[model samples]
Target: MREEKGVIIRTLQEDINNLKIEQASTLHQLSSTLSHLSSTLSQVADLQHEQNALRQELRKEQNQRLTIQEEVNRLKSKGCQCDNSSRNSTLLPHDIQTVKEAITFDLQLEMKQQNDSIMSEMSRMEKDVRDVKAKIRATAMTISGLVSSVSDLQTQIYFSAGTIRDVNKQWKTNEIIVFPHVLANVGGGYDASSGVFTVPKSGVYVLTCFLSTHSSSMYAKLILNGNPVVGITAVTNDVSDVDTGGNAMVSRFQQDDRIWIQFYIGHFLWTMSDASVSTFSGFLL
Candidate 1:
């Protein structure tokens, strides 16, 4: 009986140890699962934050689009001089008819006056046309005299050849030199260096300047007939890459009118200062 009791006590002790080991394993498994769940919760929170940010950005974009749409609607309304509210405004039928009739009456009176004026001008113009044709036919016999006379008036300045005389000088930066004198086809001389291209002709003329600056950061200025046409400027360092060459400007001129080109800021002048008389034959069309 004593041996049996000792054996029973040992069995009880072993069972208690086994139960303790199973409890410890269960605790460890629970800790691992809890850690995994915590990690999953963190990831989910991060996903939620990103989703919130995306929603905010979407809302901002939608607001901007709405603002742009409103501005476009306003501009469209102003351009058309009307809107939905104005179109929907109520008005009495008789009042609307009265306004329409008044407008129609004024339009008819204005149109009748216009027609009468147009008919009178047309009759006068027809008579002038007939007179001009008669004059042309009568002058046909004296065509040489007439041609020479018109040519004298039109050829105030002869720029047919050797009009632009390049000085062959390399114009450097901040240099204001005189251009060479060109013998006038009729009487005077043209000196571009002084910014003066004398028009010897009495008729109208078109003038132009072909100008360019050096590769250095610079801007050109074209002053023709005392009119200023500002050239393009190098805002950035790579501007030279965009436009290696310079700009040009043209202007119409009359007899004895002066034309020239200058620099806005002292820039590197290039090997190009050539001026040509554009046209000197036609009337001021």
Candidate 2:
């Protein structure tokens, strides 16, 4: 009986030690999980801060673009009237070229920065995923949220084109005026052959058209999916004088929607010997 009692006590003590070992192991695992969660939270906070900074930068860039567009509109409002006006009108195309170049440069820089940011974030995320592979169930929601936020920062789309040659009386009413010369097609949405811009993505866009005429009156319409949105006309009475007219509109478009310039009412569209006068441009906002 005495031996049996000693054996029972020993068994109870061993079981108690085993339970304490298990409890200590569980505490250590919980501590590690909490630490990982804390680190993940800190990373998320940093990413949120960076996203806010990026949004502020984007707003500033958009404002700059609006200012440039206003300047272009101001210049276009001053049509050719006298000899001095004609001289200034000659410079108008150059001014437009300069503005386009500046916009392209800024867009390129912005795209580069955005690409770098995306790549860096992607690399960091990959590392985080690898580090937390065993804890995927815990961090899955956090990773998904980060991916969604990054996706919101999309790239801009824009295009600018000009009439390559003199569009004579061959252009009839309701005909699409194809601008064969592409000055800039950043998003590859404009087709020089078809003279149509196919919407690459669904978004609000700014469409603009500028026409120049010599000794004739010309009218053009901006068409969206076979519907006329706005019209522009340039009328010149003197053979030696040039007149300019333009129209700009902001509208929404869906992916695969078509946009083009149509000859609404015009005898002919003229182009300068050294530069193009008729231009069509658009950008996604």
Candidate 3:
């Protein structure tokens, strides 16, 4: 591994050195080219100056008793550097300067376009990041709400029970005991009119049932999901007449499971307005 790392480092250093050498060579070449261009422009300007001087001399000689063709010959024989025949010689310098200006302008425009593209790309990426963060925040809030709701459901409980007030149903089979005096129905799981308690959520629940007999004996079964799960018997033969019995048990229930008290064999129970006459209850563990 160390040998590999040394080789990689050596390779990178060599590459960097080569790149620097190439860059320096390119800069030298560019400098030489610019110097040559400047020299040529200067020489062209000198030639134009000489040409103006020759024109001035020709004009003066024309006024001095000489034929125009002879004056041209004299001007040519004087070794004056003037070529009126070709216009390209004068225009070439301006063209070269124009080309240089155009190249500079194009380079500047290209650079500006590249910079704008980079800025636009950066802005788009920033917007995408912001949108992602917003979505994450919203998702986090939804998850938190769901967790809170689940916590509440996990810890919830319910209970209820009662007996009818002074009303006497003498004797019958399958008689559902209507607990009329509602004492504690915390979660509204029990319906007083139906004489039944429904499971609010599916879980293990503790249920209790009780009844009081007056002037008679009472027998009932705690009915759960249409089946008897527990039984209660209370007998009162004396005039004092307040025999009470109850049972409690734990059972698993599903959603909307039903429970109630059902009297069997015409057994009787009495409900009074006073507290503790008879009561039933249930709660989650």
Over the stretch 23-90, how does candidate 2's per-residue lDDT look in tens digits?
56655655565667777667666656666666676667667767766764554454223334656566
In model 3, which residue pairs have backbone atoms overlapping below 3 Å?
162-179, 163-180
TM-score of each prediction: 0.32, 0.50, 0.47
Q: Give stretches of model 2 more than 4 Å off.
A: 1-38, 41-146
Count clashing residue pairs in model 3: 2
Q: Rate the local accuracy (lDDT) of all candidates.
A: 0.44, 0.71, 0.64
Question: Model 3 residue 70 lDDT?
Answer: 54
lDDT of each residue in 1-285, candidate 1, tens digit only: 224324533554564466556556655655555555565556556555655665565566556656655655565555344334446655423244345446556655655565565556556555655654555454453444444544443433332112243333444543433434332323443553454456544444433233333344555444545566544343324424222233333345556765444545524333323543211111121
lDDT of 1 at 10: 59
Off by over 4 Å in 3: 1-87, 91-134, 137-159, 164-174, 184-189, 198-205, 213-219, 233-243, 250-256, 265-273, 283-285
Rank candidates, lDDT, best first. 2, 3, 1
| Pairs of residues clashing in candidate 1 | 156-200, 156-201, 157-201, 178-193, 179-193, 225-259
Q: Rank the candidates by TM-score, best first.
A: 2, 3, 1
Off by over 4 Å in 1: 1-145, 148-178, 181-189, 229-252, 272-285
